[model samples]
Target: MTAMPEWMSPPRAEGWYAEDLDHLPEAPRHTELIDGALVFMTSPQRWWHGEVVTALTIALRQQAPEGWLVGREMTIRLDKRNRPEPDLLVTTTAYDPDRTWFAPEDVQLVVEVVSPESAHRDTTVKLRKYADAGIPHYWCIEDQAGAPVVHVYELDVPTGAYAPAGIFREVMKRPVPFEIELDLSTLTP
Candidate 1:
């Protein structure tokens, strides 16, 4: 007998669900696959949260190196068991639809714009997952205390975890190939 694929099985828990990915339905908003779990993305209010994400996206794009692809809400297939749509993803190159999975080799940086509802996951769940996957860089952008701030982490591959790279109230120049342009002052209302 043939083994059944995991996605064919019934969902196992709350806060996540498995998706065929190839045949997945288009979400009304945004969604991600995490540990074979379908994680829904909530729409942000028309305020600081939304504005910050927009600013980062534009800045990263402008600054990114020629071969690097800075994507917003892109569906990255991290592993067969996990897929998460980070707020901003700095990949080595543009995506090829023909591919089936995303490995650490394909990624250079992963950024998460934190919301109150997802504070825990951004710092814990997703952080660990990204680290274990060998993603080299991670950024957690938070807007809870009026001004947006960024916490950066650099992965230690052999250990499969992250170490503090820096914490900044302003956008710092990324050392990679990209050249991002962000004027934080104009990034809000």
Candidate 2:
């Protein structure tokens, strides 16, 4: 029988905390904490996913107002036990080379480029979680027939839930989360 590695063992009876992710050097890149458990991105990312994420990051950064930052593959520490990494995020926090994660309050918008394995979590679990944490905006991008389709949502502060803002196919333009327009077709080959 095979034995599990020490780092794979839960460090506490209650399960993994958000801060524990930083201490585990053996953990895989893009490991996420949800409901006190670790979720690893073990599948090879498709080229479509890579291109879309990269292109979106560049587009967002180009239009971002001063003092705002666009980053990719960074986790958001929503609370003690939940830290999910969005594919991209726009933040008010200035550049910090040593930073590993952002607090929910600092995040202005989170974009998840949905892959097959992450579809359920991104569209449902994360949609609820981000809204519950008062993230203000969320964008879930799905590849439709080789083109990027963005589904945007805004936090309904009164209900602590997300309201559908808009969905864009060829182009995405929004005033909140800063005024910006993206030609979605350009995100991939």
Strongest candidate by TM-score: 2
Residue range 89-142, candidate 1, lDDT tens digits: 878766686654456678888888888777887889989988988888898987
Taking the candidates one at a time, how many backbone clashes does each contain?
A: 10, 0
Q: List, residue by residue over 52-79, the lDDT tens digit for candidate 2.
A: 9999899998999999999999999999
lDDT of each: 0.70, 0.94
- Quote the lDDT for 82 in model 1: 73
My TM-score estimates for the predictions, one after another, are 0.78, 0.98
Candidate 2: list runs displaced more than 4 Å. Answer: none
In candidate 2, where is summed lDDT lowest over 10 consecutive residues? Answer: 3-12
Q: List the residue pairs that clash in candidate 1.
A: 17-37, 17-38, 33-83, 63-178, 63-179, 63-180, 64-178, 64-179, 65-177, 65-178
**Model 2, global lDDT:** 0.94
Candidate 1: which stretches are off by over 4 Å? Answer: 1-19, 26-28, 42-46, 95-101, 177-183
Candidate 1 structure lDDT = 0.70
